[model samples]
Target: MQETKPQAVSRATDEELLALGRDVLTIEAEAVVALAGRLDGSFVAATRMILGATGRVIVTGVGKSGHIGRKLAATFASTGTPAYFVHAAEAAHGDLGMITAADVVIALSNSGTTAEVLTIAPLIKRHGARLIAITGNPSSALAKLADVHLDATIEREACPLNLAPTASTTAALALGDALAVALLDARGFGPDDFARSHPGGALGRRLLTRVSDVMRTGERIPRVAESASFAEALLEVTRGGMGMTAIVTPDNHAIGIFTDGDLRRLLGAQTDFRGLAVAEVMHRNPRSIAPDALAAEAAATMERARINQILVVDESGLLVGALNTHDLMDAKVI
Candidate 1:
């Protein structure tokens, strides 16, 4: 049969278009806000169940809800909770075997009556796994079958036709985020843990990288004794490729530092390099950082001090390593 042509419709005015856009946003935002008040014992129970689960969280849904479930599963996994998304329809086709008694199943369906999701609910129960349902109608079959029902009921859809999933999906996503954050806090998932999960991301590099990992150590460090001549310090700086040299006492404790900037001031004064010792011309109490500090912290210190290089010291205040802004750049920690 030939497809019927869509009826010609009148174009909306600019004002009408703007009003519709604003209405959609306002409705969705209000739906999310109202979901906050609806949190009750069921919310708490869902959180505790997932937290106590020995296996991963299996999130399942169909259509738009499936898309949201994928995102929720990712959030849970990245935040220290092990989780994976399984299409609700696929669960009835052998995927249900993936569910174990140790795992927790979180199913999403706005009406609490999605046929595919409902079909797999019994198998999840038979596996002895706890079921958490996020749906709008708690009186529906899916809600009644769940071990914990999270009420995601909304006043209405943000869609103009009220047919497409809109406000309901937004509420479901927000509820998923809420659950993930609560579980993250309870498990004490910190920045380091987050970094470990995202090693290739910028935040991961900032959090997991340490001063020791990037700082130049041992022979790579530029150092000279306090008694060394200014010429010798310059040679050490050039050899180490750091543009500066640390002046250390006989006990190997850094007493000061001399940089290219200091040389300029000496040159302007016409000071005789032959008569000057590094100890006399070097800057006293130079800024330093601990080797155990985060590379990001070192970057912050350098930015605040307006300096390019920093000395890495041990607990005893002895110089162990050194690094400059260039090292941070190479490490991608800057």
Candidate 2:
């Protein structure tokens, strides 16, 4: 057998790059997965602690964790949990008043030795509040002092340099999301309740806004007497821009609707437009809705019946209001 020449090593440096990515992914995935197994007594205990709180949740963190803390606090507040973020440094500098005995405190630290976080530990304990810690080090003072410690430790950083905080921050953020969502689910938070809290949102607008909000009442409503000339009704329609006018008797109950559609028919039939009255061309006993119907429901009716303008009358069928598709668009009911 002929002797084979030995292949020399290429001295390529790609192994470290590939291994760093794999190592970080593996550790971060394990951290999140381990959360499921560790979610024993602590998870339930945390939820009960938060739900039982009579005051807000005070979240505190240092450096990179502070950025995540602010977002978490905002999420909780907006979703009805009532929370606020406090910088650990500021907490040591008289900002501790932001927290009270009735509140629950959640502290975040990766190594658990962040000096700023440690400085406030004694105050947190003295406040008689429940302290929950999220950290990578269980033996650290911040973790040891906490009433409940959530382990967010990861084996390695995602950075190739392994100096910058990456996987650790990701693990902490994911854990925060898990905690918030779990609490939200336990509280049975829902859309209707959410809309109440966010009344400026679209869902709230649809639920809270009534037909009266967008209706044109009094002088803005286009109305014509049955005795009025077709020319007079056309003037009302042109002024109101609703493309229609309500035909009412002297008592003010809507008896018919005179529309642009009626105008087309009247003209095509070559009626003596100069002598015709609105009563001759108006649609008799046209459909009308009460002023109390939901704007969303009214919009639906308009779409289903192919009507652009609807007269808003009372239970007695008195023409008190008017609305068009443009009103729905302006109100965002569409």
Candidate 3:
């Protein structure tokens, strides 16, 4: 060939991808909205069934529906309801033994006629376990055979191709979240209760994080006499690296505190830093908290008082330790 033409390279720009994302989100939002509108007496029935359950809630599903079911089970378990996931295919085998008279089973299938789920409906009934079905089809075997049915149907999948389970799964997941939250609210589940169930998560930190857990102890604490010189207080604050020193009296009672804030105020005021006593410049009757008090409470106290440092004291008013805003931030108590 004597000459050749250069072909243009094709790639999606950010705007094009963002436009596609907006379409996907809009479609999925419609699915969730449709799912909300469909909620009626059936949703109440499902919530009542789950609330009346004195035993674990066994959730079962197949394929992508199964993945949504697993998340639903976890949410229920974390939010005051006891629940677990059982793969539908495994139920046909000896796994059915996991179901007992005291258990309530919630089965999910978009078609409601999923062979894996239909295969064990009879066995679940035989065990005297109550059955609840979440399905798209009303007349399907799983829904007809169940004690209660919760509708989670969607108009169409958000997939441009119309075959993938995109919006359908999103609708199912949103419905599951609704059920869990309703049951949680119905039972008056509080933050403290949720923290107990999730001791390893941030909820635990907010609810269980105590002042003593992150506070300094013994010799590491910054302490000085109320009558101590400014230089001595500075030494104590420097040694602790917390930018503050606790001022205590002869009886070991906390009298005041000298912090970096005090230092700035003093420097700006042109006070006699070289000769002034710490007690003169320090904050008198400084606000403090108990060791057993929650770290969140401490953070709130710090913020409300507009102070960066606080003294940890005992019931007898003796200074036990000191903590700065940095300590709370480091522990995520703030």
lDDT of 2 by residue, 86-203 (tens): 9999999999988889998989999999999989988988998889998988898898999888888877777768778887888888888788888888889876667677788677
Per-candidate TM-scores read: 0.86, 0.63, 0.87
Instruction: Name model 2 segments beyond 4 Å from true.
Output: 1-41, 136-144, 149-210, 224-235, 246-319, 328-334
lDDT of 3 by residue, 143-195 (tens): 99999888877777777787888888888888889999999999999988988
* Best first by TM-score, ranked: 3, 1, 2
RMSD of 2: 9.7
Residue 42 lDDT, candidate 1, scale 0-100 = 86
Which segments of model 1 are wrong by more than 4 Å? 1-26, 261-274
Q: Considering every candidate listed, which one attains the maximal lDDT? A: 1
For each candidate, the alpha-carbon lDDT, in order, equals: 0.94, 0.86, 0.88
Off by over 4 Å in 3: 1-14, 201-203, 300-306, 329-334
Which 10-residue window in model 2 sums to the lowest lDDT? 34-43
> What is the clash count for each candidate, in the order shown?
0, 0, 0
Deviation in angstroms for 180 in model 1? 1.2
At residue 217, give the lDDT of candidate 2: 96
* Candidate 1 structure, TM-score to reference: 0.86
Model 2 TM-score, all chains together: 0.63
